[model samples]
Target chain A: MSEFKQAEHKLLLIPGPIEFSDPVLLANATPGTAHTSPAFIPVFGESIKLLRKVLLSTEESGSQPILIAGSGTLGWDAVGVNLVERGDEVVVLNTGYFGDSFAECLEIYGAKVNQVKAEVGNIPTDDAIIQALASKPKIITITHVDTSTGVLSPAQHISSLVKKHSPETLIVLDAVCSVASEEIKFDEWGLDVIISATQKGLGVPPGLSVVLASKRAVEASENRKTPQQGYYISWKKWIPIMKNYEAGKPSYFATPPVQLIYALHTALESITAKPISERIDAHKAASKYVKDELTALGLDFVPKSRDIAANGMTAVRFPSGLKAPDVLPKLAERDIVVAAGLHKAIVTEYFRIGHMGVTAVDRQRGDLEKVINGIKEVLGKK
Target chain B: MSEFKQAEHKLLLIPGPIEFSDPVLLANATPGTAHTSPAFIPVFGESIKLLRKVLLSTEESGSQPILIAGSGTLGWDAVGVNLVERGDEVVVLNTGYFGDSFAECLEIYGAKVNQVKAEVGNIPTDDAIIQALASKPKIITITHVDTSTGVLSPAQHISSLVKKHSPETLIVLDAVCSVASEEIKFDEWGLDVIISATQKGLGVPPGLSVVLASKRAVEASENRKTPQQGYYISWKKWIPIMKNYEAGKPSYFATPPVQLIYALHTALESITAKPISERIDAHKAASKYVKDELTALGLDFVPKSRDIAANGMTAVRFPSGLKAPDVLPKLAERDIVVAAGLHKAIVTEYFRIGHMGVTAVDRQRGDLEKVINGIKEVLGKK
Candidate 1:
C-alpha cells in the first residue's frame, strides 16, 4: 500500500485507457467494498452530482446523469435503444469511424438512420445539417470528438442550429473523447444528451459508460408508447436507481461496477476542483505543443484545418513509404505508445497521439515531452 | 513503484466483490496500458484460453468465451438480446431474485417467457421442468446459484434433461454466483451459454461480463433472420473480436475494460493453477463450517436442505426479535461485513454470508473465522 505509486512502464499515449493520475489509479485499488455499503453510497451519489457540474448543469437544468458498467460504445446503445423507436428518423453527423459505428447502432435499434458522412477528418457543414433537418428528423446525433480522426465536430453550432430550425428535435452529442478536455455547455447549448465514458478526458481506466440526459430527452423516454427493446441499457430501469442515488438513497437495478465508480469519483473530484475552463485550456495548450512539434517535423495532419482538430488528440499522416509498423516500433523502443489510424480508408496512412487528462493537465510527468522526443528521434528529426 | 498490497480493511463476506488475492489486486494497479498493445494482446488471449479451462471446456467443444466490459446483468442482456429472438418461447427456472430479473430481461427483448417458480430457497423440480419443456421452448434458462437465496439449482441434471427431451433447446446457465466456486463441465454438460461476472466467484473487482457461448448459441445468433435489436451486446460484432483475440490478434469493436481484464487474468491464473475440484471442495467445506456454526446457534437457512444450498454462500434467517440492523452493526464493529436479505417476499427475514475465493479457499486469512466469531458475538451465542 506504499502510497499507491504507479509502476514505471512505457508511456501510454493512446486515445483511451490513457495514462492515469496517481490518485485515480490508487482509488481503483481500494479493498473489496459492497456496492450497497453506507460508505459507497455517498461516493456514488457525489459522483452523480459531480457529473452535473462537469457538464455545467445545475439542479434547475433538470438533467440526469447515468453511471453504468460498460465501455463508451454502450453509450451508443443507450442512445439508440432508448431514444430511437422503430422506424424513427435520425440524422447522424458523421466525422469518422465512430460516427459510422453510431449510425449502424441506431439502425440496429430499427431507426431509419440518415448518415450525413463527412470526408476523412472533417465534420458535416451547418448547411448540410440544415438540409437534413428539413426532413424533420426526430433526433440528430453528433460526435463531439471522433477518436478515429481526431476531428472535433462543431457541437455548439450544430446544437444552436437544431434548436432554431427544428425546436422539437433532440440533439445528442457523443462526447466520449471530449468531456473533460474540451468545452461543453449542456444547459447553455440546450443539448438533450451528452454521452461519455470514464476513460479519455476523465482520467480513469475504461469501463463505466457515463451519460447525461436533459429534461426533454427524459420526457421523450417517458412518453414513448413502445416498450424499450433492451433491458440493461434501458433508461427506464436506470432512471429510478439514478434518482435514488442522487437523493442520497441507495438503490439497485444491476450491480454497478464498484471499483470503477470509485475511480471515477476520484477522477471527477480532480477534474472539478479546478475551473473546467482551465482544464480545457490546458488540453489545448498540450495539443498545440504536440501539433506544433509534429508540424515542424514536416508531418501533415488528417484534419484539413487546425480549427477542426480535437484538443485531446492529434491524428497525423505518416511519411510517404512509412506505415504504422515502421514508426510505431521505434516509438515503442523508446518507451512510448501511440495509436495507429482507425479510419478504414486511410488506416495505414496516419497515426494518433493522445494528450488528455493527466497527460495533458499534469505536465510534470513530462509524458508529452517524452512523446515529442520519442517521435523526433524515431523520425530522425532534431 | 512497489508491488500492490491492499490496505487492511474489514473482511468482505458478501456474495460478490469478494476478497481478492494479493496478486489479483496488484494486477489491477498496473499502470495504464493500451488494450491493443503487443504486451496486452497475449495477456488477453491467454485470459480467454484460461476461461475455457475454468469451465472445463475443450477447444474442439466449440465453446467461445466473451469478455465484455459490464456487470453480471450485461451477461443476461447478452443472452436475451442475442439468443432470444422476438416471440421466441423461453422457459426460465426461478430459484430466487436473479431468475425474476433474467426473465424480465428476456421479455424486454420481446421473448415469450414462461417462468417456473419455486419456493424461497428451492429450484424448480425435474417434474416441473419436464412439464415446461413439453411446450418445446427454444431456450431453457437456469440459475446455477441464485445469489439472493444461496440456492443451487441442479445445472447438470437440468442440462441432461434438456438434451434428452428437447435436444435443440439451448441451455443457458446463469453462473454468476457459481463459476469458479462450483464445478461446471461446460462441454460435458452440453451447456449453450454460461453467463457470469468477475466480481463473484471469479474473486476480482466487478466490471467484466464474462460469457461462454456454445456452438449452437453462436449458430442461433448467426442464423437468425430478424436483425439484432442490440449493437453493443450483439454477438455478430463481438464474435469476430473474440475470435481474433483468441487467435492472438488484437481487434477492436469497443474498448475493453483493460484494468479489470488484467485483474481477471490474474484471478483466473490463481484459480486454474490449482485443480478446480479442490476449489469447489474448499467452498463446500467453508459453507458447511459456517452453516454448522449458525445451526449450532439455532438459526434457520433460506435453503431447505444442505444439498440445495450453494457452496459459495449461505443465506440464514434472522433469529426471533432480531433484524439486519441489530446484528449487522455488531458484526461490522468486529470488522466483518455481510449482506442483508434480497429475496423480496422475505426481504427482512435473512442475511447472507459469502465464503468464496480467497476467503474460503486460502483459509490463511482467517476471514471465515472472524465472520463466525463476529456473528457469535453479535448474537451472544458463544
Candidate 2:
C-alpha cells in the first residue's frame, strides 16, 4: 500500500526505532552470543569502541566504559544511586521537561535535587550557573536536547561554564537524543557521563542504552554507599564481566539483548565510518527542510527561536482552530508518520517532526513533501 | 581464515535471540506507534491477549499481567523482592543449579532460603517438599527446567502438591527455559507466578522476560510493606504502566523497548495461533533428532532419562577422555553453532544441542548433520 516495498512498510518518523535499513535488521537477526565466548569479547569491545567514537569519549578510565542494557532514564538512576550518597546535593538544570523528571528521579534515590529553571527555548545562562556552583553540588546534570520540548541547549557553552566555575562538580549530560543526531564531544565537553540509546540517530531498534563514564565518574561509582543499585543495572558488577568474559571467562550478567547488540553493531559502523559531522548535518538539513515546509504550510514552531530548536526535532504548533491530534491520523492513513507532543505544555496544539535515522536522510525530501501536502489537504492553508 | 561465512552464515543457534524470521525483523522495522496511540493500546492488548493463550493462564487473571523489559534475571529479583519481605522463610527446590541462584537472589532481599536438594537428572521427590511444607513455609519455588543440565522438574506434580498440602504457601515457577517449548498450564497448575523469556521458544530475539501471574500473586504484591524495591526493576510500576498505557494513558518510568515488543507481537501470534501441543511436538522431535544424531556418533546424553530431559536442549555428554570445549570450535568452524555447558556439574563433560527456534525446525537435519560430522571430525571418531 505504501512506497516502502521491503515487506516492512510503516515508516517511523517518531524519534526512535527509526526505519532501520535491511542490513541493520539482518545484523539484529544474528544469533545470541554466549557472554563468555572468547570470540564475543571483541564484538562487545568493537561495539563499545565505536560507541565511544560516536559519542567522542576518548577518556581512558581504569575499567570498561559502557554498560549494555537498561534505558536512558535509568542512567540517571545509575549515576545517582551509584555516585551520590544519602545526603549528597545534586544540581539539575531544568531547561525543559526531561530535566525536571531527571531531578525527581534523583530525589527518589534520596539525593537532594537542586533545580535551575528555564523553559523550552531558554537555557541556563553562565551567570545563573555561576550562582548554583557556589553551593558545591556533588554532580551537575543537564539535558543537551530536551526531547520533550525540542530545546537544544548549547553544549559547548555549558561545558565551558562548568569547567570554569564548578571545576569539581562532575557534569553528567543527558545526550540520549543528542548523541547520534548532534555532535557530542564528550571529552571536549568534560562530561563525566554521557547517556544515549540505540534508537535515536544510530538507526537501531530500542532496548539498549549506552552510558559512557569518565575516569572520575567510575571512581565516584566505587565510593557509592547505598546498597548497590539492583544488579542487572549495576555497572560495578558488569565491568569486570566485560573484561573477563570478553577474554573468555565466566560472564557476570545473564544473556544480554543479543540481537539488539548486533543491530547496534551494524548501525554504529555506518555512523562511525562517515564522520559524525555529516550525520549531524543530514539531521540538520532534514529538520530545517521540514520546518521550512511546515512554515510555508502556515504552521508555527513551538520553540521560541529557530537557533535554540532541537536539530533532531521540529515541534510545530498548529493554527488556533486546528488540532494536531485530528491531523495526525489522516497522515497515518497515507503511511506518513510524525510524533505528537508528550506533555501538558503542548499536546493538542503541537506535533513533532523527527529528523533522525537513515530514512530521515535517505527519503527526507519526499517524506517532508508528503507530510506538508498531507497537512494542507487536510486543513486548507490559511 | 575462519570458516563462518559472514556473508552466508552466522545463523543464531544459541538459546535466546534464537534465530528470528525476516517477517518478524521487518515487524521491528515498522515505524513505532506513539506509545500512547489508540491503535497501540490494542496492539498492546493484542500482545497480552496472545500471551494468555500461549501461557494457558486463567482467563480472568490473564486480563491483567506484568510485561517488563530488560533481562530474564530481573524476573527472579522481581518475584524475590516483591513477594518476599525480610525474615520470610521460603523453601527452594534445587533440582539443578539456577534454582540455587534464585535462592541467592532471594537472600539479597533478606528472605531465608531453606533448600531442598535434588540431582541434575532427577526431579525433586514430593517428600522433599512435603517435609519443607510441614511448618507452613511462606513460599515454595522450583525451576521448571535447568538449562544447565538440560533437565526439567515435575512442576505439574509439585504445584498440585503445594495446593493439596500447603494452600497458604504460594507457588512460583521459574519457567525461563520451558515457557513456550513445554505445555506450561499456569492456571491448571495453580502457579502463583510463571516466568519465561522472549528468546527460548518464543521464536524471537532475547530482550524481554514475559511473566504471567495468578490472582493470589497479584493480591500478595498489593500487601507487601517493603519501602519499594529499586526503581529500575520494579514490577509494581510496570504492571500499572502496562494497563494505564494500553488503556490510552502512557506513563514513562523508562522508555519501553519498542522493537522487542514488535518482535514479541509477531512471535506471540505464531505461538498462540498454533496449539501449544503442536509446538511441543516440534521441540520434542527436533530434540530427538539431535539426540539421535549424537548417539549415532557414539555419545551419551547428560540427562540419562529421556522423560526428564529438556525438549529445547538435548544435553549431550562426551565420553570420559573427550572434552566438550575441544569439539565446540570444530562445530563453530562449520558455521553450525551449539552451546557449551552452563554449570560446573557438566561443563567439561557435556555440551548442549539447542533446538529452540525456526532454524532448529527448518534446518534440523542439515544443522544436526553438520554438528554430528563436525564433532566426529574433531574427535577423530569413526
Candidate 3:
C-alpha cells in the first residue's frame, strides 16, 4: 500500500462509519483533485458502475445510480420530492426508528403516509402490508435492514407483493444498512429504488447518499404530476449529472465530494474484487459468530429471530437490570465503541454491534473477537 | 506532522477544492470514529465554535451554525425550505451564475424571486436593488463572490441598503467562494444567513455545507406560514442537533460525515489559529499578485473592475484570438489545473485560477508561481 498507516484509534464497532481499509482511507486522503478533472471523472464513473454490480443491477437493465453529497437520510428526501407528488398515498413498512423517520420525511413533503408498523422486535406482517397496498399507494418503502433494531425486512417478498397487489406502486428499499453486506438482486427482485449511503456496508466514510433507481423509478420521477418541491435532492436535477459522469464527462449540478468519491472508488474496488456473494457470506459468518457469542453470554436480541436479524449488524438487549450506561461505558473503556439503542420503544434496553466492511471481511483484524471478549469481560464483572 | 506525507499530484488551481495542508489531509485519513463517540463530539463541538470566530459571529448574538453533509447548494435549500413560504417575495442581487442558480433554488421552494439583474461580469446597481426592495421582500440574497466570473458583490453595501429601506428583509449572503478568504462580519453587517461550503476557502474537502443563521432568520424559519417543504434540509430538524452538539451532547437527526468533520476540525483549527483577518489579507495579497502578474502579461479579467473581483480566485479572459482550448490544455500539459469559465455568457472567453488556503498562505509551496509561470509559458508558446 504505499507504506502509509492510519493513526491509532478506538475500535469503532458501530453500525456505520465502520472500520475502513487502509487503501480506502488513503484514497480519502487524496490531494485536492478537481471534480471535473480527468483523474477524478473515471473514479466517479467507475464508482457508479461498481454500485450497480454491488446492487446486482446493470446499465442494460436501465437502472441509474444517483450519488450525492449527503447522508442516507437525504435519500428519503430524494424519494419524497421526486417520486411522490403532493397528497399521494405512500406506504411505509415500518420496522424501527428508520421506518418511522422515513414516513415522517415523506409526510413533510405532503405525502399521505400509511404506516404498517411492527412490534419492537418484529417485522410487519404480510397481511398488514397487503392491507396498506389496498389503497394503491403510489410508493411503498421498505427498510431492508433498519439500523436501529438490526431487523432485516423481506425485501424480495415485499417487492413481489407490491407487484402482485399494486404493480404501479414503486418499491423503494432503504438499503442504507444492507447493501454490500446483504444480497440484493435489484432487477430480479423487481426493485425500483434502493437508497443507501457509503459509511455502512460499502465501507467508505459517510457523506455520500447513493440511490439506485430502476427504469420505472426514473420514469416515475420524470413524469411527476407537480413541480419538484425541493431543489438539492431533486432527482430531476441529479439525473443529468449522474448520466454525464457515467459517460466520462464532467458535469455539475452541485459539486460532488471529490475526496469521498475517491475513497468510494477504492472501497468499491476492494468490495467487488471478488464475487459479491463471498462478501455477503463473510458478513453472515461474522454476524452469526457475534450473535451466537452474545447469546451464550445471556444477552437477548432486538430482532425476534435469527432469520430476521441483519447480517451486517446485531442489536442486543442487556442482561436483567442492565442498561446502556452499564455496558456501553465498560466497552468504551476497552477501546471498543458501539452504538446505544435508537428505537424509542426500547431505547434503553439494547445496544448495537456492527460487523461489516473490514471487520467482517478481513478476519485478521480481530475486531469481532475484541468486541465479543470485551462484552464478555464486562458482563463477568457485572 | 505525524510523519504522514500526501502523495504528489498535479497542482489544483481551480476556485475550490484547493490544495489543502498536510495536516488537514492527515486528519481526513482518520480511521473509523463514530459520530457520537467521546473523541468526535469535542471535535465537532470545537468546529462549531470556531466557525463563529471565522464568520465574526457570536453565540451571544443568538446566531446558529448548521453544518450538514452536502455541497454549497444544500445551503440554498436550507434557506429556501426553512425561511421562505409559498408566495413570499424574495430579491436576488444577481452577480453571476451562482446568483441565477440561487434564485432558481428559491423559486423551487415557492418564493416569487425578483432578481435584480446585472450585466455579465458586473454587480447589480444600488438603484436596481433599491427598486427591488420597494416590495419589502421577505429575503434579499446576495452572492458574496460568484465563482463563475470571479465577481464579488458588495455584500455590506447591499445589507446597508436593505436595512435602510426594508429593515424586516432578511439578508442572505451566498459566501460559498468567500467564507474563509473574505472577511464577513455577520453581526455587524446585519446578515441573516451566510451560506457556504468547506472546500473553497475553509481549506477542507468538499462535503460539508456550512450556514450561519441570525436569530431573526431562525425565527422566520420557525414561524413559517406553512410546513417546511423539505425534510433533510429543514432547519427545524437540524437546529436542535447543532445545539445539542455545541452543548457537548450527542444528538442525531441524520448521520454526520465523520471523517470530513475530522478534516474540517483540523482545517478550522489552522484557519482560526491566527486572527482570521490575516488569512483574509493573505488571500487578498495572493489575488493582487496574480492579477498584477496577469495584467503585466496583457491579460484581461472577466470582472469589469478590480475592486469588484474576488480575492480567492481570478477569472482571466484569454488574450484576443486565444480561448480556453488554446491555453488551458497547454497549462494542463505542465501539470497545472485551472477551471474553464462557468458563466455561460463568457464561458468560452475566460478561465479561472484559484489561490486560496495553502496556495495563498504557504508561500514555500510556490503553487501560485507555478500556475502563473505555466500560464506565461503557454502564452509565450502561443
Measured against the true two-chain complex, the DockQ scores of the candidates, in the order shown, are: 0.87, 0.36, 0.90
Q: TM-score for the first chain of model 1?
A: 0.98
Q: Write the per-residue lDDT of candidate 1 for residues A269-343, one digit (tens) a residue.
A: 988999999999999999999999999899999988899999999999998889999999999998899999999
Off by over 4 Å in 3: none
True contacts kept of 1: 0.89
> For model 3, how does the per-residue alpha-carbon lDDT over A48-140 read when each residue is reduced to its tens digit?
999999999889999999999999999999999898888999999989999999999999888999999999879988899899999899999
Chain B TM-score of all predictions, in order?
Answer: 0.98, 0.91, 0.98
Per-residue accuracy of model 2 over A173-279 as CA lDDT, tens digit each: 88888888887887777778887777777777777767888878888888666665355556676676666644545565676776677778788888888888888
Q: How accurately is candidate 1 docked according to DockQ? A: 0.87
Of the true interface contacts, each candidate retains a share of 0.89, 0.40, 0.91
Shift of residue B312 alpha carbon in model 3, Å: 0.7
Best by DockQ: 3
What is the Cα-based lDDT of residue A245 in candidate 2?
Answer: 43
Model 3 agreement with the true structure over B1-382: per-residue lDDT tens digits: 5888889888999999899888899999889988888888999998999999999999999999999999999999999989988999999988889988999999998999999989988988889999999999999999999999899998888899999999999999999999999879999999999999999999899999999999999999888778888899888889999999999999899999988999999999888889999999999999999999999999999999999999999999999998888888888999999999999988999999998899998878999889889988999943
